[model samples]
Every structure is written in structure tokens, then in C-alpha cells.
Target: MSGILSEDALDTLFRHARTHNAWQDKPVSDETLYKLYDLMKWGPTSANCSAARIVFVKSKEAKEKLKPALSAGNLEKTMAAPVTAIIGYDVEFYERLPELFPHAPEAKTWFNWSKEWAEQTAFRNGSLQGGYFILAARALGLDCGPMSGFDMKKVDEAFFAGTTVKVNFLCNLGYGNPDGLFGRSPRLPFADVCQIV
Candidate 1:
């Protein structure tokens, strides 16, 4: 059984964590990016259908390519970030079930038979993985600014053209600039948003 996390750990992962809009000049190394993925990949997904694909846009050229897709609100901060992660959903991810879900060799057939079901599963699991990505980055002492304010078609064309992968969302990763943070937003109380039933 897993032991409970310390209060400090919970604060780092949730309570005090903020969506940063500005970044310090520090860079996030390629090795750290890989490590971030290695940690987040272990998060759960339906039938273990790990369908999230990620692209770390750290180069000037790549950032420029992504610029046109960003909404006006996201452009400046995204460009300033040390790395912007393009979290995408792989529609054909089920094909890998033979390997990812080796215990059930027939798993791929379930998704292959229905394009609609496949698409839903991809988007849902991909979004879940995106959440895990944020937590993993935080655990590694990095901050995140996740956003959906972008032109999906443009992002798909720029990053995943002729491929089964499609952009789900974008997350800027870096050391956050505290001066850029706004007041924390309020959340719905547990009684209002959850139920014991």
C-alpha cells in the first residue's frame, strides 16, 4: 500500500500550484523533458490505452511554427516559455494495444471496430494524460500553464500533418515568474461539485 503524501507534497501538486503566464529565462533540458514523459506515462487510462502524444517545442523555429496557431492571449507567454508541450491524441493508438496491453491481445479490435468510440477514447484518455503531465512537471520542480486557446487545425498541420495524431491542448513549461501571476481563482466547494452516492 502507498503511504500518504506529506502536506508539502500536496501543496506542491495542487493547493499552491498556479497557472503561470510568464517564465524565467532558464531552459528546460531535453533529458528533463524525457524524464517528465517517463513519469506521466504511468498514469492510468482506459484499458491502458495510452494515447497521448507530446511534442516539446523548444526551438525558435518550432515556436514560430506554433505561433500562428495560438490565440492572441496565449501567444506572448507561450513564446517566452522555455518549452511548450503540444499534447496530442493519437486516433490510431489502439493499434499498440498488443504491446501496451499485452495481457489482452484482442484489445485493439474493440477500438478498431468503431471510429466514433475510438475518437472518444482517444480524446478522453489524452486529456487525462495531460493532467498527469502537469503533475509530473510540478513534481520535477517545473511550473505549467495549460491552455486550449489555439487554432486546432493550424496546430495539426504544423505538428502532425499526415499523421493519426491531433492536437488536444498546449502547455507551457518553465520556471514561473511570480510577478506575472494573478490572484488565485476560486473553486466550487466539495458539497457543490461532488456527491457521496
Candidate 2:
């Protein structure tokens, strides 16, 4: 079994990490983005569905395309970020089950039979992958700002039109500007939010 991660690593991934609203002038390189995905892709998904798709919005042209879809509150920060990742879920992701879940060659048939089930599985696993993306970014020493304040329909039309992918959420990536941070928010205690049963 693997040993527990050290305190420094835990703090880097969780305790000391903050959701950044503003970014420093530093840019996130394309190589870093590729490495981020390389790490996050290993996160598990049900039946190995691996349904999450991502569009890294880095160029001015791409950011402009995303601007109209953003809520007023998210517009400025997103545009200022070095990168904004549009996480998407593919409705037809199950078709790749034969390749992703090779142990169960017929796994694709399960979701193919029911549109509702397929959609559910895609969203569920896609969201899980999005979580993994966040942790992976943090591990790579990048700050993240995840938001759902954009218009989903507009995003889909702008970025995923004519494709089976649908927007899940957006996350901005960069080195954070500490001056832009809000006060640390409180969280529920384990006793209040969880049980040992």
C-alpha cells in the first residue's frame, strides 16, 4: 500500500490552497496544460467511462468567444486569467467504452440502450473528472478558480456546436494575486456533515 502524503503535500493540495479570483501577469505554458491533463486523466470514473472533455481557452480570440457566455460577475476575472478551461461531458462517451474499459468489451451497450442513463453517467463521471482536474492543477503549483456562473447554452453553441459535448463548468488557471483573495471561508465540521455508519 502507498504511504500517506506528507503534510506539505496535503497543504499544497488542500489546506493552504485557495480559489483565486485574480491572476498574476505570469502565463501558464502549453506544456503545463498538457501535463495537467496527463495527471488528471488517471482519476477513476465509473466503468472507466472517462467522459470529460476540455477546451483550454488561452488566446484573446477564444476568450472573446467565451465572454458573451459569462455572467457579469465572472467576466472580468475569467478574461484576466491565463487560461480558462471549459470542461465538457460527451453524451456519446460510452461509444469509447470498448477502448477505455477493455476488460468489459460490451460495456458500451449498457449506456447505448438508454439515453437517460447515458446522460446521467456522463455528467456524473465528468464532474468527478473536473474535481480531479482541480487537484491536479494544485499539485502542479497552479491556482484555480472554478465557476458555474456562465450561460451553458451559449457556451455549448460557441464551443461545442455540432458536437456531442456539453459544458460542465469553467475553471480559470494561473498564479494567483494574493491581493485579490477574499477572507477564508468556513467549512462544516466532519461531525456535522459526515457519519461513521
Candidate 3:
């Protein structure tokens, strides 16, 4: 927990990772999905709000259910991937603070301050958890194709109707087909994006 990871490990988690559009005919096991969540759940969230919820669409029926919500560019790849994870934020996440935050039962009442603020907190922390999900998958030798090109309302209606959750984004997961990769895009250097006092 205190030491730096080797260069290979860093590459696996970040540098070498690509947003894959094509995948091998490989299946991600249910056990592996369980392990993925178990690893990602430890990422710190404000007040341990732990608002992110995921729905893994794998079977034909589930994929069909999610189909109409996908944008044109995402449709083919999403339908072909081994798994498509629907990451969502729970607006009413504060309800579970008593257990997830423990020692501060009063933390749950903080949501009473404002509905808007609670929603903002949920979305922010849930987005953090979603980042953790991608890194966790990459660490496990899986490729990720995270995308925002979907009809949010359609996704929420298809997967989270009657629930407190709402869809945030989608990520297709599998063993990537390197033949589909394009040239890596350039990133802004730290000097251009950072500040020092």
C-alpha cells in the first residue's frame, strides 16, 4: 500500500490501456465480475456514500433490452462485447450512510440540507467509483471501452426504472482485438494543465 508500482504495472493500469472497439470471443466469468467489484469497492468516496451501482448486461435478453438506448457508434461494439456495465448514481445514497459510514449515523441527515446538493454529491462520488471500476478491470487483464454516447433517459428507463439509481455511463468489457486499435491520441502535458504555489 506504500510502495510505487513497477513500470509494467503502471502501463497495465494506464499507459497501455485503450478504449477498444473490437473484442476477442472471450467471456468474462461471473466470478471475475464479483472479484472486480470486491476490489473496486474500497476506493474512497465522500462520507463513504458509496453511491455507484452497476448492472452488467451479458445475456442476449439483457443486451436486447439495452440496445435501443445505445448511440449509432456504440451499438455494434456494445452488442458484441462480453459485458456492458451500466454504472449509475443513487440519489438517495444517504439512506445507507448508517452502515457505510458507521460511527456517524447523523451523516444520513445531512442530505436533508438540500436535495440538489445530495444529487450533486452522489453524481460526483459515483463518477469517482466508475473511474475505479475501469482501473480495476485493466488490472485484471480486461480491456475497457467506456463511452458516454447513449441516450441517458432510455438507459435509465430500461435498467433503473422504479429505482433510486440513474445511469451515468456505459463501458464495454472484454479481451480487446488489437487489430481494431487506432493510433494513440496525444495528451496535454502536466505543465499545461497543472499549477504550483
Candidate 4:
């Protein structure tokens, strides 16, 4: 259970997985969303700060609320999606550290030193959780369309007003349509992107 995974399992999570732009007309149920969170929450974060906050925009009304914030090019695909998740980071995430990182209660005060430090931790850890979300969704038979083509400030106003949360990125989730998939692009060779010490 602790070794490298089978090729098929790896393919499901990476090699063949894609960022989808088109989706089939299907709905993602609340139960699936709950399960996705339960699975992805286990992904590690620094001191287990666990800062990611997500809002699933599924209803027509909710989608409309998100419309004005999306870039023109992202509007169509996102609107057609079964669910568009607004991934955010809570600037006040450290407030929960006393409860979340209780083994060391002093953890709550670590990020309170400065606004910049807390924000940096929140963005970094929240982004890691977002990556976990995409893989978790793919592993659970769902396709993903993670994107950043939106107005972050507007999205924050529309979805997170009166809160310390700020939008980091958006993801559309559902069954992807093969008819809309684009050709795979090349990736950097190992030598070009990595090196052995």
C-alpha cells in the first residue's frame, strides 16, 4: 500500500488526466462534493493550517452571480459546467490553529506576527490543497477544469464578501466531453526542468 502505484492509477491521476474546458450535461451531487473534501483534506499543509475554502457554484442563480467576474474567454465553458468551484484562502486561517494544531497551541500565534506572513502561508498551503482537489476529483471518476481566468477581486466580492477569504483560482467539475478536448502539448524534458545533486 506504500509503493509506487500501478500505471493505470498513475495515468488516472496524471499522464492521461487533462484540464477540461467542455463538459457533459451532468450534475455533481452534494454527496460527491463532501466526499471530495474528505479525501483532499488529508493532503499535507504546513503545520496543518489547512487554509483552503471552497464555494461550489452549481445553481443557475449561483452561476449568474459568478458570471460578471469571469473573463470573456472563460465565460462559456464555466457557465456550461455542472459546478464551478471558487477556491479561496482565508487570511484569518491561523485563528483556528489553536484547535487544528493543538499539540502545539502556540502555533496560532506564529502567523499573527504580520499580515504578509499569514497571507503568504495561506496562499501557499491553500494552493496545495487546490492541487489535491484536482487529483482527488480525477481519482473519483470526475474530470477537472482548473482555471485562473477570472477577476479575483470581483469573485471575492461576489462570493466572499464580509469574510477574510480571497479567491485563489476556479475549477469546473463534471464529466468532460471528449469532443472538446484539445491536443496534448509537450512538457519539459527531465534535464530541462530537473537536476540531480
Q: Candidate 1 — which residues are off by over 4 angstroms?
A: none
The runs of at least 3 residues in candidate 2 whose Cα sits more than 4 Å from the true structure, single-residue gaps closed, are none
Clash totals, every prediction: 0, 0, 0, 0
Global lDDT for candidate 3? 0.95
Please report, as a residue range, the 10-residue window in candidate 4 with the lowest summed lDDT: 104-113
Report the C-alpha lDDT of model 3 over 44-97, residue by residue, as the tens digit: 999999999999999999999999999999999999999999999999999899
Q: Candidate 1, residues 1-197: lDDT per residue as tens digits?
A: 69999999999999999999999999999999989999999999999999999999999999999999999999999999999999999999998899899999899998999888999999999999999999999999999999999999999999999999999999999999999999999999999999997
Taking all chains together, the TM-score of candidate 4 against the true structure is 0.98
TM-score for each candidate, following the candidate numbering: 0.99, 0.99, 0.98, 0.98
Q: Candidate 4 — which residues are off by over 4 angstroms?
A: none
Worst 10 residues of 1 by lDDT: 96-105
The global Cα lDDT (0 to 1) of model 2 is: 0.97
1-197, model 4: which lDDT tens digit per residue? 48998999999999999989999998999999999999999999999999999999999999999999999989999999999999999999999998889999799789988999999999999999999999989988999999988998899999999999999999999999988899998999999999899
Model 3 TM = 0.98
